[model samples]
Target: MGCLSATRSKAIHKIDIPALDWPMARFPRYKYPLEDYVHENQQEDAKCLEETEDLIHKYNAAGKPVAAILVEPIQAEGGDNHASPEFFQGLQQIGKRTGAALLIDEVQTGGGPTGKMWCHEHFDLPEAPDIVTFSKKMLTGGYYFKEEFKPPQGYRIYNTWMGDPSKVIMLEEVIRVIQRDRLLENVNESGDILMKGLTTLQNQYPQHINSTRGRGTFIAFDGTNAAKRDSIVNKLKLQGIHSGGCGDKSVRLRPALIFQPHHANIFLNKLETVLSNL
Candidate 1:
């Protein structure tokens, strides 16, 4: 699996658990306000892609062939980090050249958070990934795969229930609601307002926060420190606006797709109140 995060410098999750000695490559750390960081971010992309290729080669030469490479469109659990489309495109090419099946994990950023059905769709990959694992917003856990990845024989990927059929029924209703309410459009509209508010807040509180980033309504910002981050979350909750933190000092926004512009304003207003108190 390909692991990406700046917070690795802090600690690795579940290090006590036994894990395969797989090759881990660093993903890019792009400067925020992506448009302004184009040149630098491109360089960052090249660097990470090169490191990935080198690691794959090194492992293969040592007779530890990597069967697949796993990545997240937006490394959600790893601090809501993001990489560029060009970066993802290059990684796909490298995976193809190296004969490693490309797997995109959309556990958090899928189901319209990034203004698309799937975050990987934003990359404009030449073809679908070999595997696409999803859950969270999907209201279930499963994966889609290219036909070639299908098991040649039955029972290869079976489980007691495989997945709950009841969940499927619930998902059907969820899909209906998404379509009936045009939630994707709502996601886009609310995301615009939320991001603008975040940018303004970031500017106003530069000493306490920075690195405001995300697509659609999936947003996050880094606090000055871990304590400050936790305090912000706690304060927001006490004010009746719940939020979450990831990495060491990042607050993530995970509003539902149906969340409207007015709801975005309420969140921002709560955030402003919290910042003032902080």
Candidate 2:
């Protein structure tokens, strides 16, 4: 029901769909090296949080109560925008005080890519999210929630495209392999390598790329502008790595959980080669 309404981006202007009249709140933008800009980031988070609460209250007063607070742990499609864990904590409290369910869209940050089964786990929320939606790397699509959220009516949500049970069955085995092989550990190891190597690259090529950020292998860095970002993506593909671009002018990295130290080293070397010529 909310599919058409989910898109809340500047490019939403380009889409000619009849979206619902849901109130939209701004997602916070933070400076990279989150440590260096802690004060500014905290202020940004506070401003967004206040606006979100005001929107919720205004809509409620207008008799259109906010039901669920949906968010991505890291704004993957929104160019990998990230907020501090404290920001999430604030949102969760807002949800609790307002009886709004916290619905985390984990399609881009799930299945152990963030060194956890779900990215929200990093926030240490008081309780599990009211609902957790997942897809993509999980090999199927569905959402899970605490028992309290069970639908009040039967057949409230049903669809033929709920996805194949076989995919879920296969995914069960995939989970086993991930656990048996300790892939989360591998992700952490590779993530360290990526952060270290990317930091070095950022230092060396500040003009071409900057603000390298991400968790685990789900990383990204910005180019000077959209044109340079596209060129970087194209150059990376030419070098035999199928890289992708996201947001306005950012190159994103969404490597598999099985990516290892050697894989990180290879990506770094190839990326360095790309930056060197740029």
Candidate 3:
């Protein structure tokens, strides 16, 4: 059980089923407009990383030496939480020191949502992770490991049909189109617009929304409260602009890579109308 799987959703895991008892380390909860709180955020990162090391030692003392540390580049389902590159780099060191493999789960933050092919790419890891898993936008569910994690013998891990051939073909074409059309560029462009517009809205309607934060088009802002978040999402849906809520009162925006400036403008305008009405 020390070769752990941190795969459960932070929201509903308690109500679902019994889980292995793995100690949870604190994830850095940063303040909104990250640039404004640089020192505080850095300290938060240090605090969380220190706790992670402490947990590893505690688990080791219990005779269950930690074998792996699984994390997300951006904690999407866990309210889209994010940690600094330094935190992740420090985590990799902890894994090395503790002989635990570093596994990064990218099911939600993958496929160029954060203006990067993988969200961790933004982290600037000194080396590749021990294991990286992908799905959803990837159109296939699979994991790739570093050479060391590969099977020692043939057929140790085997799969004939990876997934539906149709999905594979579509995935290939999707990658091609993304490259040919330079959709990542488009994501950055659109994301800039969206973030700027959202920040303005946050300032303009502080009571309705705040804590606007994100990278590229993977954006989110907090509602005044949970009820207010539900109301805002519902109102946006009524206005023909789809939106979603995650992680308490945070409204997460999962715009496609191809989402253009015009689309961002329309969405922002609709959001403004909703906030104004609220």
Candidate 4:
């Protein structure tokens, strides 16, 4: 299938892969402290959306029409980049006009990591997406699509263990635990604490770090440079906190569903100590 992806700048997930000879549109890059640059960020959104539409038209003109458009609701590996709701709404309209399936890659943001079963639920699209691919926290890789997009015949797509009953059994228990413990609620509560703490740290250490952003516990903050970012991650590991890097210099936080406010506090304190030593 002819496919094209529009992702955020510095997207680590898309690096070093031989991609199809399809188009790549620019994703919006907003200014820090979003409230301070409202007009600028809005313009950024418009520019990116316009570019996306133009690429779809250009690809069609080249005799290789785009059958689908893939995107992440919050570009996780792209430093937790986020776009406004209006931006996603505009994209849906483009997909409708172009008759291209809107395929959302929710592998990184799905299964309650973003305080929602599916991150696109936060976007408020007019209708369900044409396709959604998931894995990672979901315990297995799969795609959900509208009935119209379903293949007419079976075996069109097959895998080694196509009908794995054991995976389903495990997923059932995972679902039960999530619902029984209200993990989504826990994610929200912990996310607030993490976001607030990061914001305060950003304010306090304006020179060392900035651009803290996320939805739920899927959060990140940028370091002053690549070396500083690596240093922070290493130091956090030494302090009994395992963190990772994304994008150019972003320190990402991927906490589990059971993570609570107390856990966030410990993380915040450890992060603060790391920054202080740097």
Best TM-score goes to which candidate? 2
- The digit string of per-residue lDDT tens for model 2 on 1-278 reads 37668766565563776677788888899998788999999999999999999999999899999999999999988898988888899999999888789999998898999888889988988888999999988988778999888888987877775667789899999999999999999988999899899999988999889888888777889998999999999998988888789899999988888889998999899988999998
Better of 3 and 4 by lDDT: 4
Off by over 4 Å in 1: 1-16
Alpha-carbon deviation at 113 in model 1, angstroms? 2.2
lDDT of 1 by residue, 112-186 (tens): 888778998888888888899888878888888999998899999888887878888998898898899999899
Q: Over all chains combined, what TM-score does candidate 3 have?
A: 0.93
Question: What stretches of model 2 exceed 4 Å from their correct place?
Answer: 9-16, 158-163
* Candidates ranked by TM-score: 2, 3, 4, 1
Q: lDDT: which candidate is best?
A: 2
User: Which ten residues in a row are the worst by lDDT in model 1?
Assistant: 1-10
lDDT of each: 0.86, 0.88, 0.87, 0.88
Off by over 4 Å in 3: 1-5, 8-16, 160-166
Number of residue pairs clashing in candidate 3, backbone atoms closer than 3 angstroms, sequence gap of 3 or more or interchain: 0
Candidate 3 C-alpha lDDT tens digits along 1-278: 23223555553445545567777788899987788999999999999999999999999999988878888888887677878999999999999998889999888888999999888899889998899889988988867789888779987766676456888899999999999999999999999999999999999999999988888899889998999999999999999988888888889999878899999999999999999999
Q: Positional deviation of 35 in candidate 3, in angstroms?
A: 2.3
lDDT of 1: 0.86
